[model samples]
Target: MLVGVLSDIHANRIALDAVLDDMPDVDAMVCAGDVVGYNPWPAECVDEMRSHDVPTVMGNHDRAVVTETGFGGNGMADAGVRYALDVLDDDRIEWLAGLPESRYCFDGRVRIVHGHPDDPNRYTYPSLFSARLLGEEDVLIMGHTHVQAHERFDEGIVLNPGSVGQPRDGEPTAAYALVDLEAMTVSERRVEYDIESVIEEIEAVGLPEATGARLRKGR
Candidate 1:
């Protein structure tokens, strides 16, 4: 079975749409988290994921939106989270709240989480925790650092699809991953969209201009 793995959507409809359009047919799809937060289209992005019926894990930003636990400070990132919380309707908020912090899929062969296996808010990077986190599962997928990566360990494989909305790996393109369960292989993928359009929308909506500027730089 082919599985499309995505995470850190961060509410950018343009980037999400582009990734969805580029994604190939798969037996299933899963999102690691951060479905909402940052960018300007919180509702639209959540609605899109719901429409597709993708099983998603909760990220720190999604938690902030539902719990009203602000990210702190007056920085653009915090402002984006506040804006996302304010704009997301009750249904979207509930949906974000209902998401699990972690999940096992493919009959427990694949484990999915937003951050680390132990802590959903903690970031997990390649070669850092795979040895400690890997177990009997055939694959473990996570996202949080906004950097695309694929790692293998004696225990299993760890994959990060990167950030679908805000990529901090110096690449503006949306990042994702494809897992071939039957083949036991995983591949990282990137899709380019109209960053300018998203930036314009962010500016038009009065969100921090830094939010849009980050997309241009992929910082």
Candidate 2:
């Protein structure tokens, strides 16, 4: 089976739309998390994931929304969370609250986590991936650093599909991955979206301009 892997889809509807449009057909889809936060359309992003029934693990930003926590004085992040809380209704918030920190999917062939296996809040970049992190799953998927990278080990595969909305890896495109389970292969992907339109929407919604600016820089 083939699966489309996604992560850090931080609430940018335009970018999300672009990613979906560009993705190839797959048997299933999964998210590393942060389905909400850092953009104007938190409610829409959440709804998109729900509509597709994407099995997602709780991301740090998703946790922030449910727990009413913040990065502590990070105005950009705080604004996104507050906006999500304001726009998302109880049912959606409940769904976010219900997201597991980690999960085994595809019948134990894959493990999904927002960050690290040991700590969901920790950023496990591709460089840090090693056989040591692999337990029994064929693949260990992590998100949170907004970087697109993967490593193949004799034991298994470890990867971050990158950020769909708020990419910080200096690549100004939506990032994702296609994992071929039967083939034991991974394809890193990027999609171009309407950043200017999203920036305009960000301004319209009264979010910090830096939030939009970072999208252009992919910072």
Candidate 3:
């Protein structure tokens, strides 16, 4: 089966649309987390994911919005989450809140999480491959760094599809990955979108201007 893996969508509908358009048809798709945060169009992003019935794990931003917890970052980061919460309706909020912190897919051959396997909010770098964390899973999928990575370890394989909405890998294009389980191959892909359009939306919606500017720099 071919699986499209995405993460850190961050509510940019344009980027999400571009990635979806660029991606090849797959049997299923999975998002690591951060479906809503740091950008405008949170509702649209969430709605699109729902329409596709994609199985997603709860991201730190999603948890913060649902639990009314502070992001503990700069004022802009806090504002972004607040804006996302304000724009999302109760049903969407409930859906975000109800998402599992982690999940096992393909009959436990794949493990999906927003951050670390032990902690959903922890920022576990891809460089730190741990057999203890992976356990017996054949593949481990995680996001949260906003960087695309595919690593092979003796214990298992680790894949991060990067940020679909807010990429920070010094590349403006939206990022994702395709995993062919049957073939045991993985391919990373990037799709360019109209960055200015999303930036305009961010400014129009009164989200932090830096949020939009970062897209241009992919920082």
Clashes by residue pair, model 3: none
lDDT of 1 at 135: 67
Tell me, by TM-score, which candidate is best. 2
Per-model tally of clashing residue pairs: 0, 0, 0
Give the runs in model 3 whose Cα sits over 4 Å from its true position: 130-132
TM-score of each candidate structure, all chains considered together: 0.96, 0.98, 0.96
- Estimate, for each residue in 15-126, the C-alpha lDDT of model 1 and write its tens digit: 9999999989899999999998878888998998899898899998899888888777757768778898778778889999899999999899999998898888787766
Whole-model Cα lDDT of every candidate shown, in order:
0.88, 0.93, 0.88
Q: Which candidate is the best by lDDT?
A: 2
Question: Better model by lDDT, 2 or 3?
Answer: 2
- Candidate 1, residue 22: Cα displacement in angstroms equals 0.7
Model 3 scores a C-alpha lDDT of 0.88
Q: What lDDT is reached at residue 80 by model 2? A: 92
Instruction: Count residue pairs with overlapping backbones in model 3.
Output: 0
Cα lDDT of model 2 by residue, 38-92, tens digit: 8998889889999999999999999999998866789999999988888999999
Cα lDDT of model 1 overall? 0.88
Candidate RMSDs in Å, in order, are 1.2, 0.7, 1.2
